[model samples]
Target: MSDLRDAAMSSKAWPFEEARRVLKRYQKQPPEKGYVLFQTGYGPSGLPHIGTFGEVARTTMVKRAFEVISDIPTKLISFSDDLDGMRKVPGNVPNAASLEEHLQKPLTAVPDPFGTHESFGHHNNAKLRSFLDTFGFEYEFISAKEFYESGQFDEILKRAVEKYDEIMAVMLKSLREERASTYSIFLPIHPETGRVLYVPMKNVDAENYTITFDDEEGKEWTIPVTGGNVKFQWKPDFGARWAALGVDFEMFGKDHSTNAPIYDQICRILGWRAPEHFTFELFLDENGQKISKTSGNGVSIDEWLTYASSESLAYFMYLKPKTAKRMHFDVIPKAVDEYHQQLRAYETQDTKARLNNPVFHIHGHNVPTSDMVVPFSMLLNMASVSSAEDKETLWGFIRRYASEASPENNPTLDDAVGFAVRYYHDFVKPAKTYRAPTDQEREALSDLATALSSEEAALAAIAAKNAKMGRDDPLPEADFSDPEFLQAIVFAIGKLKEFEPLRDWFTAIYEVLLGASQGPRFGGFIALYGVEETIALIESALAGEFTK
Candidate 1:
């Protein structure tokens, strides 16, 4: 078998193990058309947070694993329960004036306070889709609104009617155990109409909307109620949906572990198997608060993507074990670099012999090497500098530089190029800009300027000397570093620094370095951006006073 396949087979990732367990559990059962992997979450009443990505990303990982091992088709289902009533007005929703009226309406029908969409639910749902697509996640997205409108819940409702007493008792028991009380079972109430629209529960004889049971006193009484048709009442609902969909695996935050038994109960009720569960801890921000959109405390995937690539984002997600550990964005760059290094290591055919392997290194006697590569930001910066704006360029860099770079390098030359481009394009300060440089940053710049003076002078002398050489003559890399040429580079960088606000500084630097003012980073930016562009930008930055 190819090493990649071998590695995948030996993988310890949750997806792999959960998929195997699922396959074995159904090994002799009636053939299923396929397994469904579910990621369920409420639409953000506020901006969607990074935790939202955790649900989908982890589920997608398991889905891919099923495809890899079991030949069992896997469908990633993103269940957006927008039909659920709006509980609290999300901060992002502007104009909270009509919120009270919106309480009973399906979230999709609720008007956005911002007045940007037909309803607040519609606006938030769009943000969720946009966020998922930004990460290239493929899912069979289903809204509770559509499921209700389509009457998929008809059979479920009928079943609830037949088992009404039992289901209610179970739910009520679970609720009481959890120290909660409910006057009515949670049902999807049509936002437009205050009435509960019943989808007939299949195979159950429900008499009207009333169910009756004899109390301990033996006097039978009818209670006006909607069938406890919703997934699970109490906490077990999560498990019921899991079994209903044949989910092989699902993850939850640490807070949900107390309700784990609900999964078993739901499985028994449906006569379907339960999925393996992995409980990841809550993500925390730098300030030590648990990451949450409700609290306005956590960074969202949208925010992270502004500084990192989708792969890098995925890499970071996979860094910790999918159980009981929290992560912050500040530590993400390192994880991304490590993942890149691993990819590079996987590509090496003679990896065992290369003591100088850039992607991996021996840790101890008779020990296998571990992978470590440049950060994602570095690669991105490189792409930003180059004319090429695609993943292929970045991938090629990994393949080509598998023998030279190391993680110790803050941003390798390649990374510098990528980071420069990314910083310039995405976060570049425009108009009036104030860049407050830390003491360390200032020192680094001063050191770079001094180094540039000699490098420029040397390059200038070499260009003059090389002028006599034919265009076809072989160009030596060393010729670009003659002392006089190096000095000229120093002068240019120094001159460029005098330009006004940070925007002007970057513009002048790029124009001199790459002949493009509106492009990638300057120092590491040019070097990592693209080799060809780096050379071009060097020439440009050398030119005087960049302006329109």
Candidate 2:
């Protein structure tokens, strides 16, 4: 434990680095609240997106890292601002027009478009919980509606009333001069109608913990700040929530980087210290646009899981998080293969190196060994060649190469086979462009065919000679299954033909055979797809079977 803690103290992994910062918070003394708290805020205006899932996933990494470094009890809050007014209806939901009548009302007060939950907010909150729950995140869900109405935030709301000028002074400095005139710290909800009232306060009665305001109908009313009567504007809410929860750590996107100071100052003004803040760059789509839940330009959690494992998605989230990433369907195969590579590497890594390994943090001491007998990219290429329409068809080829492997014994690999078939049909098959091999490539490919034929004849001769000699010279175990041996054969052939830098030879194989511009190692492909089958494929390509 001491050794692990020491390693975490100096580890360069971002999670560990953030955990070290959290540890510094309590270095001088234990927390006043008796436990360190990590909070992630969610606005349930729309279904939870990948970026939302990322916050919980990434924060869990830091929290897990902190657990390794300290014995302090830790808590993570997945807080939802479900009480926030519906500023605009989301464009993607079913029956979008039905929500038009309810704009400006609290999300919890709006009718659900999906007809699943009590309100739109509940529907989305349920989704966010199910999304996090599906990935096995440990967190407590807190609804802003419940938090305020249940009087959990009563004291803080009153405090905001008492410190109105100090908090507003800090807030007004950030807003434009024209907008500052009408802005108030407290936004009240109508007593009769459910819509949130955005009018400026006529007068604030700090002693009574209430505010006087005029409704849109020009009616005067003063409401107590307690029992969900009022909620802070977003900027003030940020700091107030931090103060109320004593959140030790929270992470937000770089967009919020500018407003972090306002949150901190409000937290301090409300008589609580600010939490540690982590600013991660936003995720971008294929077109390099920031991923927005409303725009729907990026891949969703469901779309990613369609082609890869949840662990692979988590691995993608674990990578270079401070930098923006393109979360598209095309990146899934690479993520799946690389995640397994890291898992395999973790098996032999030392304690220091293991601490630095993502899998160590992903699975801790319970890392599962990868059951993938074939790489994912290879499976993708195999799917392309075989035109596999189902997992059963792909399994036939898989069993041919690995006679011992079955879906029962290799569930992970079996899943990849299914994903391969689907991904090929969806993305690869449609995009495949089979260009004819150039003159040089044709000559090289013909030479490859001649080389394989000669090699086969020579092997047959050796076997016959061995039989005549009465020597049982069995080949090495899993000889055909070895990727390196098969790759060596192809590499030797490429060198003999002298394909110049040699990538052109490989490219010829991919374009002429797989219809892809890139592919798995051809030697590895030959090993799994069978040497005779590959030889036949080469002949067919040379015969213009593909280009025709």
lDDT for each candidate structure:
0.51, 0.87
Give the local distance difference test score of model 2: 0.87
Candidate of highest lDDT: 2
Could you say which candidate leads in TM-score? 2
lDDT for 45 in candidate 2 is 86
The TM-scores of all predictions, comma-separated, are 0.61, 0.94
lDDT of 2 by residue, 37-143 (tens): 99999988887888999999899999999999899999999999999999998987999999999999999999999998899999999998997898888899999
Worst 10 residues of 2 by lDDT: 457-466
**Predicted structure 1: lDDT:** 0.51
Question: Given candidate 1, what's the lDDT at residue 263?
Answer: 59
| Residue 388 in model 2: lDDT | 87
Q: Write the per-residue lDDT of candidate 1 for residues 364-432, one digit (tens) a residue.
A: 112233333434554544454443454456656554445454434424334434543454455432321
What are the runs in model 2 whose C-alpha is more than 4 Å off? Answer: 454-481
